[model samples]
Target: MTIALEHPVLHSTAIALPARFQASYTTRLVAVGVDKRPSDFWLETAGTPQAGDVVIARVTAINNHKRVETPESRKAILFEGVLVMLAYGHRYAADQFLAHVPEDLGPCHLVAAGGIAGTVTALHDRVDEPTEIEPLGLLTNARGTVNVRDFAAFDNPLKVEAPNKRAQVIAVLGTSMNSGKSTTLACLVNGLAAAGQKVAAGKITGTGAGNDRMIYHDAGAHSVIDFTDFGYPTTFKLNFAEIRALSVNMINVLADSGADTVIVEIADGIYQGETSRLLRDQVFQEAVDHVVFSAVDALGAKAGVQELQAAGLHVAAASGVMTASPLATAEAAAVLEVPVVPTFDLTNPEIVTAVLTDHA
Candidate 1:
């Protein structure tokens, strides 16, 4: 079967195959090969693709499998691998044909499905291991030069085991939205990971925006996750009791992530009532190993720690404030009698050690 030049086979969104393939393209293709693991292609592709995207490839003739059936009347094609959706669903937005690899890499095929393909940029053997990042990406709806799409939590409920069990769990809480919760989580994750601790980071509560967890991942955490990944548009629907349960459950999941340390984020502030009330819940207050509070002012920071301690909750360390306000950090540390490490001074070993050791 001859292939046309116009039909570019996309190896990835970034890389298209070289030119059109020879006449044997179709004969060498298979919709889903038996030998290649269905899950491999998926795990390799997550975190890179998104939903409503196109993927083109020539079919190998070895297997005549029924394509994921989509009635002609249907608006779009749907691919199925028993574990594909559940496996990579939350990592990246993916909508395309599914296939196994460790097979032949014949000529690429056609547009296949989804919206139009973007320009091909890369095509290398996929990686199965995770990588570290800095300045975790925040999910945002508003437009900008850097941000691409508005991030919203999956519109449903989800449950998974936390990433690690023995890992130290430290959650970063903030006084209000945009108060640097994400930024602080990143720094803490990086510091912990650099200290030889395997860290899995997450944002368990918030408006359910996306960028914050991205920040955690970028910060050097071995694995990063969020409430959005847990399938919630925001934490508003979650009562304090729910968050308490979630915190306990999520901490366990992160612990299972095989990391020596875990960073959890509570969006908004300790005084936000919802956030504060949630953390102080017996389940969370008991399970959490540490708490990093982000404050807008010294008084708020002081009060938040005092209240959490008064309620018998753990206070890990204080980091992140709007400006260069030593007074605020100092006052917070003085009142709480804990280290008040600032983001600007995140690199200090003494402070970091104090945080890692003292918090736990």
Candidate 2:
């Protein structure tokens, strides 16, 4: 098999690969859905890059994200001039950078460690500039520009039918980024698994990163998947309709996995654009059976609970970073009717069963 490179500077037309030459592209986790065999595709220098379009780029400068997560979920250190296989996608990280897919395959920033390339529009004060990369070109084949959605694990058209034997769906939401949502979700998974319940987990939203998914798997979930499994690098800028479909699809997929219970983590906070929309959507509300709100403080906990309650969601309990503080916990528990279960307590099967079963 032969691979060709199409670049005006390199050649007037496509050039064939040398017989001894081999492609050694470092494929990122975001492109894990696509086949990694370089020989299966070629590089097209012409065309506008769109969201989810796979691209081959070289690191020009290192900054915030010094390493890129690989397809194997391993973090590979990045260096100048290192060719990487990533996807063009938008990013929304309040603690990091807010980025959008570029109009062309021009120089952009590595907005996410999960291997998302985009143009950084805004960033938090504490975060350094995003790592810069020069887009070589979009990956292409006989079908034209390759997209992550082309290899989605569940690509069937959206059919939001109620599962006949669906698992109990528990959703974990937080006040904001790093509000302990993933931790709470993991502890819940551990506790439920410890209680002898078959559990499946999915992260329906958020940037394409493996940290939360890894935590869920380590917590003993029978199966684990995220938005990446459905070919979305991030759900930041997606419309409410798209987000709703993704949410329902993920829930149905996890339920169909044969687990008795499905625990899902909704990335970001209650106030996030997509999160807020999902919270208000009738379909989303019907899909989730219980909600666990995570917050960093008493104020956030109170506000988050109110938001969930207003959305007509059943708040099971409150647990998160605030659980680390006795005063904060008491303050939140006093103002809110829901019990403030500490993170450690959440890992106790008895406590978890009581909280969820009582709510049930």
Which residues of candidate 2, in runs, are more than 4 Å off?
1-37
**What do the candidate models score in CA lDDT, each in turn?**
0.47, 0.81
TM-scores, each model vs. reference: 0.53, 0.92
Tens-digit lDDT track of model 1 for 1-360: 222222233345223222322211111111112113222121112123332111233232211122221111122222221100100011111122222111112222121111111212222234221111111111111121111112222222233323333766777786666566778878777776666678898777653233555577777878776654443333543555556656666677677778777778876556655676776566566566777777777777777777777878677766776435867666666766767788755555456667768556
Q: Against the hidden true structure, what lDDT does model 2 obtain? A: 0.81
Clashing pairs in 2: none
Root-mean-square deviation of every model: 16.4, 3.6
Task: Give candidate 1's whole-model lDDT.
Answer: 0.47
Best by TM-score: 2
Q: Give the least accurate 10-residue stretch of model 2, judged by summed lDDT.
A: 17-26
Q: Model 1: which ten-residue window has the lowest total lDDT?
A: 81-90
**Most lDDT-accurate candidate:** 2
